[model samples]
Every structure is written in C-alpha cells, then in structure tokens.
Target: MSYHAIVIGSSAGGLHALKTIITGLDASFNIPVMIVQHMSPQSDNFMSRYLNQLSHLQIKEADEKEPIRQKHVYIAPPNFHLLIEEDKTLSLTVDEKVNYARPSIDVLFESAAYAYGKNLIGIVLTGANSDGSAGLKKIQEAGGLAIIQQPQTAEVSIMPQSAFDACPQAIVLSLEEIASFLNRLNNDTQSVAQPTST
Candidate 1:
C-alpha cells in the first residue's frame, strides 16, 4: 500500500538513529517526513542543519502553516508542538508539554494519524523515556503502520520497549533493518508513482 507520510518520534540517543534511517532513504524517496526529537527548549536549528548536510532530502525546522511536501523532512521547533492539520498543512503551538516535552511525540503522531489515517507511518526510535508509546498505539488504532526500534538494539531501550508493550503488533527492527525497510517502502512507492511506458 502507498503511504502518504511518515511521523518519527525520538529522544535521548535519537540523533544517531535518525541519521542512520534518513541517510538510508534513497535520493528518489518522495514522501514527507515529520520528526519530533526531544530537545531542550533553548535548542536551535542545529539538528536539522546537521541532518540536512548528511541527507539527500531537504531537512528544516517546520514553519507555521507550511504545506507538507514530498522529499522534505520537517522537524518540530523547540518549545513548540508540531501538528498535522486535516488539510495536510502544518501548525505549531506552545501548548503545555505532554510527556514533559513541548514537542511531544504524542501530539504529532495523534494529529498525523487523524489527518492521514491509514496513509500514515509512525516510528518510535531510541529514547530514554516512554513518551511515544501511546502515540504509536493511536497510529495503529487508526490503521496506520507502527514501527519501533528493537529494544535490544536501542541505545536506551525504555522508549522502544514501552512502545512495544503498548502495541505488541508493531514491527520491531534494528537500526539497520529499520533503514532497509524504509528504503524498500520508498522504492515500492517510487515504482508505483512512475508512469508506465507503453
């Protein structure tokens, strides 16, 4: 099945995990990816900038009202919660923190599940806390795909383990395996999008 978007949530040992997965994406990968990486409220755009330098996709801090576009990676800004609107546009809020994070993984994943439903893919990467488990479960309930980093391979296993506990059906993969799975999905989607020659 063709997926429209991907929502990723992470904390703690997230940077390395994000880099591994994003770098594995093919240059032709054409899907919007939204990420909520737990950070200090004073954090800057350095993470996005750093990832952009190493990725084929354009990675940036998401802007208010920005339309979600393919081949671009949008990261939630510090001290703000990023949400996906039903119209497929982005909105940002300084709402009270959930899971003690302004850019809570639950906020993004729930809104994305509502907006994209079965067309969404939600991923929970390595983290120290159980922040994303509920959100990933919501994604699964909405018929979206749910994936979690294998607890054994996670630098901090609490988050992935919590997610797996919440949604036992979610696929659990190592960092490398997760990357390969995304690449395969990208390839499949790309093949479907290409025009068939007579």
Candidate 2:
C-alpha cells in the first residue's frame, strides 16, 4: 500500500529511537512524518533542531494551522497537543494532559488515524508508560499499519510491550529492522508512484 503519512509516539528513550529512524530515511523519502515525544513543558525547540541536523528530511516543530507537507518531519512542540485537522492541516491545543503528557502520543495517533485512515502508519517506540497502546490500537482499527519496537530491543520495554498487547497484529521489529522496513516502504511507494510506460 502507498502510505501517505507516519505517526510515531515515544517517551523515555524517544530521542535515540527517533534519531535512528530519521537518519535511516534517505533524501528521497516522501512520506510525511509526525512525532510525539513526551517532553517537559519547559522544553524548547532544541530537539527539533538536533534531529534536523541528523536527518536528510527537514524536521521542525509543528505549527498551528500549518499544512502537512510530504518529505518533511513535524514534531509536536512542548506544552501542547498536536492534532491533525480534517483538512489535513495541523492544530495545536493546550488541552489538559492525557496519560500525564501534554503532547500525548494517543492524541496525535488517534487524530491521524481519523485523517488518513488506511493511509497512515502508526509506530510505537521505546517508552516507559502505556500512553501509546490505545492509539496504536485505533490506527489498527482504522485499517492503518501498526509497528512496534521489539520490547527486548527497547531501552525500556513497557511501552512497546503494551502496544503489542493492545494490537497483536502490529509488526514487532528491532530498531534497525524498523529503519530498514521503512526504507523498503519508501522504495515500494516510489515504484508505485512511477508511471509505467506502455
């Protein structure tokens, strides 16, 4: 299938996991990626800048009412919940925290599922809490693909394990395998989008 977007959620060891995945995508990768990595409300834009420097794709904090564009990575800013509007633009809200996180992974994933339906891919990475499980399940219910980092390979296994339990059909892979699989998806999508000569 030609996935249009990816929504990723993480907590504890999220920075390292995000870095690994973003670095794996080559410059030609076209899928839009949205990420929610739990951070303190006092955090700044440093993480987005750091990840952008490490990735070929442009990485930036998701802005209010900004359109979601392909080949870019958007991260939820601190102290707000990043949501996908029905029109596919972004909406940021200072809604009360869910699962003890302001930028809740569940919030992002659920909204993306509603917006993209089967064209979405939801991935749950290393985390300490169970915040992403229900969201991943929602993605699966919407016929979207679900991927979870292998609990054994995670820095902290609870989050991935919880996702696996919630969505047994999720593809469980190690960090390296996840990267390779995403690259393969990019290649497959490229092949599908190319016009075939008669």
Candidate 3:
C-alpha cells in the first residue's frame, strides 16, 4: 500500500535516532515526515537545522498553518503542539501539555491518524516515557501502520516497550532495520508512481 505521510515520536536519545533515520532517507524519498520530539520549552531550532544539513529532504521547524508538502520534514517547534489538519495543513498550538510534554507525541499521532487514516505510518522511537503508546494504538485502530523501535535497540526502552505493549501487531525492528524498511517503502512508492511503458 502507498503511504502519504509519516509521523514520528521520540523523547530521550531522539537526536541520534532522528539523525540515523533522516540520513537513511535518500533524495528520491517523497513522503512528508512530521515529527514530535520532546524538548524543553526553551529549546531552539538547532535540531531542525542540524538534521537538515544531514538529510536530502528539507527539514525545518513547522510553521503555523503551513501546508504539508512532499519530500519535506516538519518538526514541531519548541513550546507548541503540532497537529495535522484534515486539509493537509499543519496547525500549531500552545495548549496544555500531554504526558508532561508540550509537543506531545500522542497529539500529533492522533491528528495524523484522523487526517491520513490508513495512509499514515506512525513510528515510535527511543524515549524515556510512555507518551506515544496511546497515540500509536490510535493509529493502529485507524488501520495505519505502526512501527516501534525494538526495545533492546533503544538507548532507553520504556517508550518502545510501552508502544509494543499497546500495539501487539506493530512491527518491531532495530534502527538499521527501520531505516531499510522506510527506504524500501520509498522504492515501492516510486515504482508505483512511475509511468509504465506501454
């Protein structure tokens, strides 16, 4: 099946995990990725800039009411909750935090599930808390793909472990495997989008 977008969530060790995955996606990858990485409210845009330099896809801090474009990665800015609207645009809010974080993974995943449904891929990476567990479950319920980093491979296992527990059908893979899988998905999508010679 073809996917339209990817929503990723992470907390502890997120920089390394995000870097690895972002680097794995080559220039041909067309899926738009939205990420909610737990960060201090006082954080700046350094993470997005750093990842942008390492990735072929455009990675930037998500802006309010911005349209979601393919081949781009939008990261929720500090102190705002990033949400996917049904119109395929992004919405940012300073609403109260969930799971003790402002840019809650659950918030992003749940909204993306509503917007993209079965065409969405929800991923939970290394984290210290179970913030994404409920959201990942919601994605699964909406018939979207749910992928979790294998707990053993995570620097901290609580988040992935919790997600696995919440989603028994989720595919568990190491970081390397996850990257390979995403690349394979990109290949499949590209093949499908190409015009077949008569």
Model 3 residue 73 CA deviation in Å: 0.3
Tens-digit per-residue lDDT, 15-63, candidate 1? 9999999898888888899999999999999999999999989999999
- Root-mean-square deviation (CA) per prediction: 0.9, 0.9, 0.9
Candidate 3 residue-wise lDDT at 153:
96
For residues 1-198, what per-residue lDDT tens digits would candidate 2 score against the true structure? 988899999999999999998998878899999999999999999999999998889899999999999889999999999999879999999989999998999999999999999989999999999998999999999999999999999999999999999999899998888888998898888789886787
**Cα lDDT of model 3 by residue, 54-88, tens digit:** 98899999999999999999999999999999999
lDDT of each: 0.94, 0.94, 0.94
Query: What's the TM for model 1?
Result: 0.97
Task: Enumerate residue pairs that collide in model 2.
Answer: none
What stretches of model 1 exceed 4 Å from their correct place?
none
**TM-score, prediction 3:** 0.98
Q: What ordering of candidates by TM-score runs from best to worst?
A: 3, 2, 1
